[model samples]
Target: MKAAVLREVRTPLQIEDVQINKPGPHEVLIRTAAAGVCHSDLHFIEGSYPHPLPAVLGHESAGVVEQVGSEVRTVKPGDHVITCLSAFCGHCEFCLTGHMSLCVSPETKRGQDDEPRLTSKKGPMMQYLNLSSFAEQMLIHEHACVAIRKDMPLDRAALIGCGVMTGVGAAMHTSNVRPGDTVAVIGCGGVGLAAINGAAIAGAGRIIAIDMAPGKENMVKAFGATDFICAATSADVVKEVIEMTKGGVQHSFEAIGLSKTAEQAFNMLRRGGTANIIGMIPVGQTITLMGAAFLGEKRIQGSLMGSNRFPVDMPRLVDFYMSGKLHLDDMISRRIKLEDVNDAFTEMKTGAVARSVIVFDA
Candidate 1:
């Protein structure tokens, strides 16, 4: 199988032939159909986040089950599925308490002594986020993927595996945005747009989209942003949001994962409102908050994978897409082949495209 392998940080991923192992007990082998090039993948590639080298780096994907391990019962050989990074060990303390996204038991991955799932001519290639959908196929734990309807397009379904789920789940699950509420989302990238769409779906009365890119204002409006704020010239974003809402927004989301934006999200929240951080901020960066802000009952929290229970939420997202409520077609800025992954990342770095999907051959 051919895969885009990250040989070094800040370098183009090498497209090379890689070997994928068969499914282990409780594992499933999926033939990759479509994979979304997400910002999280760029973070590790640019050394913003650290991970093992020679890894295949893609997490947001959807595919068809090529094979299943003997113990895998959640999906069959022919089922269509969306892969998630949050592979949970159902017996873990977190999973037992309904917080499956936080499960970190060793059972979810191959033991250190076990043979690696992927290997290149050099040696075993580390799989990124347990899915590594950048390759032609993915061998992952059954818990890492949820089977979805066959009618859903693999390209669009791929978005729900990560960005869509993260954005929508952040609003509906993490912060619990209510109808008639006002929401302000920082950053207008794929995740930010999804947050705005989620806010609309949640019936938020006012949705403000913030971005430095002037062109994105239109896209944001199309995604249900009630108003757009250009961050470039806006000296006081929090103040602008407060004035626009006649006060502060009921909920605020930081999707860019920057310290400044995260602080702004908290500052823009109304009294008793919640600020949800959805971006994967780099490790070791500290964010400072107003000490007196808590006196008003305001809170700031981190959201993991939209606090998702993939099995339940993924299908609902698929239904939402099928019902025409989720506008996925516009979200996909372009589609390219595996060889074009480097260019896609370059485009993403420029903040010129919403999402560039890697469509695999059937």
Candidate 2:
């Protein structure tokens, strides 16, 4: 199988032939249909986040199951599924408590002593996340993926796997945006646009989409943003948001993963409002905030994978798409082949495109 391998930080991913192992008990082998080139992958590729070298790097994807392990019952061969990075051990405390996204139980992966799931001529190749969907195939724990309807296009389904789920989940689950609430999302990328859409679905009365690019206003508005703010042109983004809402919004989301944007998300919140940080801020970066802000009961917190329970959330999200309420058709900027993954990353850095999908041959 051919996969995009990252051998070092701050380097281009090498497209090379890699070997994928068969499914073990509780594992599922999928024929990769489509994978999204997300900023999260760029983070690891640029060393903003660290991962083991010589790894196949991709997490947001959807595909068809070709084979399943003996113990796998959640899905069968020929099922369409969306892969998620938040693989959970079903019996863990987090899973039992309705917080499956928080589960980091080692049961999800093979022990170090066991044979690696992927390998190359050099040696064992590390799986970037539980699901390395950049390759032609993915061998992952059954819990890492949820079977969805066959009617949904795998390319659009791929976006639901990560970016969609994260953005929507952050709005509906993490911060629990209420009807008639005001929301300001800091970033109009795939995740941020989804956040705006999610907030609209949650019935937010005013949805403000913030971005450095002024050209995204029309696109962002189509996704349910009631207003658009050009962060680059504004003298003070936080102040502008506060004035626009007459005293700050009920909820503000930091989707850019920058310390500056994160602080702005906090500052743009109304009293008793919650700020959800959805972006993966690079390691070692600290976000400083005003101590007096706490007196206003403003709370800021991190959101992982949009606090998702994939097994339940993903299927419903699929239904949302099918019903024409999810607005996924406009999200895809373009589609490319596996070999063109590098160019997709190059486009992502510009922040012009919403998502670039890697469509694999059937």
Best by lDDT: 2
**Residue pairs with clashing backbones, model 2:** none
lDDT of 1 by residue, 272-324 (tens): 99999998888889899999999999999999999999899999999999998
Model 1 C-alpha RMSD to native:
0.9
**TM-score computed on alpha carbons, candidate 1:** 0.98
User: Which 10-residue window in model 2 sums to the lowest lDDT?
Assistant: 45-54
Model 1 per-residue lDDT at 354: 89
**Residue 285 lDDT in model 2?**
92
The TM-scores, one per candidate, come to: 0.98, 0.99
lDDT of 2 by residue, 34-112 (tens): 9999999999989888898899999999999999999999999999999999999999889999999999999999999
Estimate the TM-score for candidate 2. 0.99
Question: Would you give me the overall lDDT of model 1?
Answer: 0.93
